[model samples]
Target: MSVLRPHGSAFSGRLGWGRAPAVVVVDLVRAYTDRDGPFGLPDPEPAVAATQLLVDAARADGHPVVWTVVRYAPGLADAGLFVHKVPALACFGEDAPGHWGELTLKPGAGEPVVVKQYASAFFGTTLASTLHGLGVDTLVVAGVSTSGCVRATATDALNYGFRPQVVRQACADRTPALHDSNLADLDAKYADVVDLPEALAHL
Candidate 1:
């Protein structure tokens, strides 16, 4: 879609942007971005490419650009039950090969990269504190698997008192139905479901 307009959207109002807005790119790693990888979905290239624009805009706007990745310790000791539900998460193990844990976006020098063991970036990570220090009040979210990590992070961003905005073009899921449905759910209650242009304007 070229705009922020969502068809048949049940949502009423836009939370819009707050005083300080930050961008959070979730799990855009080889395990999710790589087509041949175990956890890989179809092609997320368009989503990844679209996200760079928002990322650059956020950086230029002087807003914090945070990246979240799933990395587990040896023997998957820290993963809890999530690992068992999705055994493919082993691809992000500390002892996993370098290529398996590769990041699609090479974070800039000062960009904060939050390593998470669970779906939400706020879970078992310093994302909240990092955002606190950066004085972030709104979060522009983008990343792989809209129904998974992206959804989890956006939900937590709202629960943590930050206005969350999910860019439709910058987030992907394995199927179109899953992507559209989740975005609808988020727009109805959790966050604002926007397009690339809308996200940029907020930044």
Candidate 2:
């Protein structure tokens, strides 16, 4: 009898880039990049730098580039249970001081920005319809908090019938452990966790 290796040993199938691909930058805002902010990651520069490369490549390739930012109504009224669970999310409040919600990696003119209050960019957003209208079948996802928004967006992209390619170098988390673990799980099941060059070539 053959012995099984591990949880992800048999799940190594790859979903190469499809006919139409879009680069999705998820929640790469000052809230997480600003070192002094409540939800800031320790070392977010590398991820930000890597994501910028993906954005540039997508723009040069004439592919769609979608951006997501976390925003909530005044007094956290629109945050629902999410704010309750993570009180630090108040950094995204409309009145949050100093524009904590601003995107660190600026989007190009006319790029679509999706405002989301949840981890998954598709939740309560028009991202799916927009992608459909643009004829985008594959999504190259890059952004902050690999264990949170990035993972959520990539998984939802796959659930919504879009091939999801998560760029490993373009994602950050509170710690390297969290970042690596989530990427492993995502690559094993939800999306193809690809390198920056692989994603850029695909774009």
Candidate 3:
């Protein structure tokens, strides 16, 4: 009863599952998880919890854990095309309280937190270098907006020579239909869309 279909391509079915795998939790900030925040589209708490579970598992297994959150500079004029396309996210402006929330990790602590500005966590960020430095050959991707940031990050992960394993239940979109549709397409062309439990069990 899995929703994934075989994707025949170079990036298809080539995930090095047993390789040096790491978990990348993208944009699980309070602004996106809060149901009432401007950037909040739907209830992403379940996805956040699922992601935290994966993070815990990865940490226990000695795999690298990386967290990404969107950060903006002071002044709306400095915002990029993403902010222009989705003006609602302006609420995450610099110094906004919305940006201050309980991220996956506490500040000044364990794993490095990569601050991103666009949909893809890899864009203009140290994610690639960090993963490469860690010898990460596979990525366990879990985060919000299945059709947006998650999809973009998975695609780029493949291009960057990392196997992208997207946990289905660990990702959510504004609409359930959108979430399902993106997961299907991702399975068909981008990454292996596996349920969180099944993926963890296999791992």
Candidate 4:
């Protein structure tokens, strides 16, 4: 690997893909996907597009697919401290418009949709146990706001004993600086930051 920035010392290595892998698409709802919405951005589409390929690959390979969505209660009762940090998150309320609370990347009927109140799919959710029940040993993590949800999920995957393969192209943020930095740190310590093709090929 080319060294763009130096790590003080080696603290991590590639966990790689396991035989049983599942794809978890995190927070690609319309609120973040549509340019007219509050958290929307132009560059997130590429990540969404890349993730679509991984989803297809996972389905074809007969692996389970899980999609995570962030939806706050009517009064933002479950949003916790995040609501105070980013008031724009209120736009993801259940009453948000069709193009706001909806998922940009639609899931198949059999695929599971895990609604979350926070960033990481694992945080205060049945995600970890669900994956365990499905015998999913590796997590193919892809989704929006790479610096937030993507990074959080990847880190949590490591802690939860599941190998997280974070597709670099299948993860995005409002700013490239945030996306790049988070992925760099995740690669150095938590997950294997890989290209879309590389991840798909492995799966």
Instruction: Please name the candidate that would achieve the greatest TM-score relative to the true structure.
Output: 2
**Cα RMSD to native, each candidate?**
6.0, 2.5, 5.2, 4.3
For model 1, the stretches where C-alpha displacement exceeds 4 angstroms are 1-11
* TM values, all candidates: 0.92, 0.94, 0.87, 0.92
Clashing pairs in 3: none
Per-residue CA lDDT of model 1 for 44-145, tens digit only, reads 889989889999998888888999888889988998999899988888889877567778988988998899999999988899988988899999999978
Q: Using lDDT as the measure, which candidate wins?
A: 2
lDDT of 2 by residue, 71-163 (tens): 999899999999999988998999878788999988899999999999999999999999999999999998988999999999999999999
lDDT of 2 at 200: 81
C-alpha positional error of residue 14 in candidate 1 after TM-score superposition, expressed in Å = 2.3
Scanning candidate 2 in windows of ten residues, the lowest lDDT window is: 4-13
Per-residue accuracy of model 3 over 116-138 as CA lDDT, tens digit each: 78888899999999999999888
Q: What is the lDDT of residue 141 in candidate 1?
A: 94
Clash counts per candidate, in order, are 0, 0, 0, 0
Q: Candidate 2 — which residues are off by over 4 angstroms?
A: 1-9
Q: Model 2, residue 12: what's the lDDT? A: 71
Deviating ranges (above 4 Å) for candidate 4: 1-9, 97-99
| Rank order (by lDDT, best first) | 2, 1, 4, 3
- Which portions of model 3 show Cα errors greater than 4 Å? 1-16, 100-108
Query: What TM-score does structure 3 among the candidates reach?
Result: 0.87
Which model is ahead, 1 or 3, in terms of TM-score? 1
